[model samples]
Target: MGTEVQCTLCPTECELENHQVGGCKVRINRDGTLYSLVYGKPCAVQVDPIEKKPFYHVLPGAKAFSIATVGCVLGCKFCQNWQISQALPEESEHRDLDPDEVVRGALYYGCQTVTYTYTEPTVFYEYMYDTALLVRKFGLLNSVHTCGYINQEPLRELAPLLNAADVDLKAFTEDFYGRICGGRLKPVLEAIVTLREMGVWLEITNLVIPTLNDDPKEIRDMCRWLVENAGPDTPIHFSRFFPYYKLKNLPPTPIETLNMAQQTAREAGLRYAYIGNIRQSGENTYCPSCGKLLIERIGYFVKQNLLQEGACPYCKSSIAGVWDQT
Candidate 1:
């Protein structure tokens, strides 16, 4: 009988037989040993503004050296990076950059942090883990923009090394997760709470798709849950969803919907809520206590930051975020 290995990294718990790849399309079991096919092989690499990660609460106006491999655990229908996220390891061209090299690239580019983004970082767990260790040693921070689909054990192990995270909360309902994302909602929610408990500076992104998850009640419920579990200080970004990938049948999210979602987050006791993907007053950060503009941002660029040592200069209200690399 051939031996099999179970990948417990994510909730999917894909058990694979010899020579079979797991559901993530990156991990394969060979002779009872499981190996990551995408480790040290990232298909997407670049330097982006930290705001581009939609991380408003972490080192505002800093640059992040971003990297990602070519596979994901959950298949989201409206994935913006589907070209790389849904492709197999062998299907895309990748750079052979090891952990040390990744740290070197970050230093070379003058980045304050190394971000695992553009695709689900959980899919390249080993690579991200190793690089995160080196990133810390080199006096740089580690961040990830993930879908929050990871299991508890792996998330706990990785949390200490992670300085910040932006979890894509997709939607509030299990029906939406199962139908639109081909995954479950419970684990994602659990991961978010776990990230908060682990002392990681956490932000959330909810891509509001029209007619799918734009229901006001559902949005309110999600914001309330986030406030209750992840704390009222956690920043949430209500991003406008554009039709793409397998979800092209749907139109872009209405501007009013994004605004309403942000308003709901605030009403739910979330201190910092912002609208993303479109230019508006929501792109800037204001003091939750005094409502004074703390950071003025134009798209991904920070025009001015009036924070004095992570506090609102106007009202002296301390903001919630990793303001400095130290």
Candidate 2:
């Protein structure tokens, strides 16, 4: 038997023998050594608005050079990017962009941050790590939109490099996580708390899938937990879910449901709760102190920003976000 090694990058902790691949499909064990198959081979690359990453609070209106490799830690049924997230390295089309090239691309495109997004960045750890070092060295920021399914050591090591993270807190229940996302919920919650503790700017996204995880009580519970653990200043985006992938049978989340979720978050003491995936007033940022409009946005486009040095321009309340790159 060949030597077996355990991949501890995520909570799944896949132990693989020689020539065996991990659950993420991006890491392979070869002759007693583990190798990341997707390093420096991102399948998706784009210059997107920072708000497209749904990072309303982080350098609003700035562009992000986003990149992602093929593979993910979890298999969410409703994943919008399932085409790349669920593909094997050999099955996907990718670019030969190395870490230094990635940083250069961000600079070339005049992006304020380099984002690891579209798929799980955790699976592309080595690539993200190396690129993040260069991104920081070049005076640019690093951000990620992730599922928050990473282990503690790696997360801590990567936290310092990350300027902001938009975590998909898919649902509040372990059953929902297991049934809908093929993962557990505890580690994600732990990761959220750990990120906050490590001083990384954190945000949360919950895609409201009509019957699956849109319970009002559950939303309240999730918001309360965020207030208690991640703090009330943490912005939570309740996104409307449209039928896609394995979840096509379900109807799109009712507008009322998203509204209820936003109300629930505020009632649970969360200060900055926003609705996503639809055009509404919820997309704008308002001062949690004096209820003054801080930033006006329209579909990822910032029309006007009223924040002065990360604070409300009118009331001067310190808004919680990476509003300035410096």
Candidate 3:
């Protein structure tokens, strides 16, 4: 049982008894002490653009030190990074970086933020939480890219260190979540709502796989739910899905599907919807008020920025997102 200690990290409030692991396979219960085994031991680390995290809203055009550890709570059939996402701590190699060392490394690399990414950061909850706290102490912000499978108690406990989050709503239907992902949909939705309520800058990513979770009606429904819960101005990235890992028989998501998804979200009242992983000019940011090109991006690199102190330079309308240039 995950009941020996309190664990509401990401919807999986796996209370541990003595000498057991939670559903995520990283957190451990050792003789009544619940310890996150992956703490201070990052299995992976890299430096990347902030937009690569697909967080176009948080500190755009900045560098973020991205890190992750092995293990994941949800067992999705089509996981792109299953080698690490499904591997145990021993199964994957790790760097000898501690939480404090992580902060120092980000600073050394000229990164403005530390991102808990690559794999499910929630599975490595202890590592991410400790590192986030230490990273924030150095004045660098902490962000997370997660599937939003967290419990309320643990999320609140870690909120002080959390700044921004890119949570995947995954799919709208519980059937997709249960039959395909071996998880429930309610908790993911709850985590999104909780993150918003906790004042975390929230962005959403929905991977539209062909014949799986790509029903246009369902996508529209999901967008409506986001607009209702996360607000219309919230940025939602309709990511392109490729045939990878276990779902290789299917071809990559068509560009047209991505465009349609974007239009669907915008029609549903999401003002900042985007189509990701495609090198289209439409990827550039436009002023929501005046349709002026605000920030131009080519792939992950920023080409031109027209924001004057966080407001659109053309219309002077207040844009959403944090861009303090710190």
Candidate 4:
């Protein structure tokens, strides 16, 4: 079998012929045409907190109607959602929720956003892009929790409708991304730059796995790069790695690591840094201009909201996030 057809969604650019799939198991070449088997097909759907997306910056505390299709473009060894993220279209249980149905569900669930999450939306491009167009007209924001792994053309086209996106900057080193994620680091960086340049509200998540991608120097480098490329105001969530999927033998990331990561980010010039999947005291979201808690969160619950007209009510300093016009 000669590999000839090209897939430009990521840097992989897997060339393939009929009966062949790209580096991602989901995209296939059938009789000379590339098609996504997951299109218009959803395997999981629910309403979750925008905070759960670790998007503490956008619509904080609002419920977001979330959807995910089976199959992932990049196969990560420590995938937390591998059950849904790594499966064939025919392998997972699904709901026939079309774009129209998705809009209805968001409104029904009293959600202000529809999140294409739990898997890489880039692989299911048509399904997500079309759904985003429809949902925006109904006053619903389109949010994506993505790996930032896509070609510039598709990313530019989709950036307009996106109200917010939480992109994962997996690691700073190419070796980590190449070996673990089955992806390249450069395209992900490019996509993040393009998103910020396109004026899309953005957040970044870095899942620190022990002995894999968690070098203090690497984390510092990642944070520095984020501040330089995506802007210092971009919210960065340093999520604690829980052993799952193929990483069952590794112990969960310690609380100290998450805190240290957040501190490193702050020291590196990130204005808003957070630690996820851990319970304990954390100094999250203080006014960059004046030290005051703008939005205090502990374990996914918003304990205090100190914003008045999107600015800190205490010291009248401007906060860097979208606040409801309440």
Tens-place lDDT per residue, model 4, 1-326, is 45357988777788888878776667898877888877778888988988898788887788989998987778999999998888877677888888999999899989999999998888888999999999988888999999998899989999998988999988999999889888889989999999999988899999989888778899999999998988999989888899898889999988878888988999999988888888655535788887777778877777777777878777887777766612
- Per-candidate Cα lDDT values, in order, are 0.93, 0.94, 0.85, 0.86
Tens digits of per-residue lDDT, candidate 2, 128-223, equal: 999999999999999999999999999999999999999999999999999989999999999999999999999999999998999999999999
Candidate 3, residue 292: the lDDT equals: 88
lDDT of 1 by residue, 1-326 (tens): 66888999999999899999988899999999999999899998999999999898888889999999999999999999999999988878999999999999999999999999998999999999999999999999999999999999999999999999999999999999999899999999999999999899999999999999999999899989998899999999999888899988998888988889988889989998999999999999999888999999999999999999999998898998999988
Instruction: State how far residue 242 of model 2 sits from its true place (Å).
Output: 1.0
TM-score of 3: 0.94
**lDDT-based ranking:** 2, 1, 4, 3
TM-score of each: 0.99, 0.99, 0.94, 0.95
lDDT of 1: 0.93
Clashing pairs in 4: none
Candidate 1 clash pair list: none
Instruction: After the best TM-score superposition of candidate 4, give how far the Cα of residue 246 lies from its true spot, in angstroms.
Output: 1.8
Which regions in candidate 1 have their CA more than 4 angstroms from the true location? none
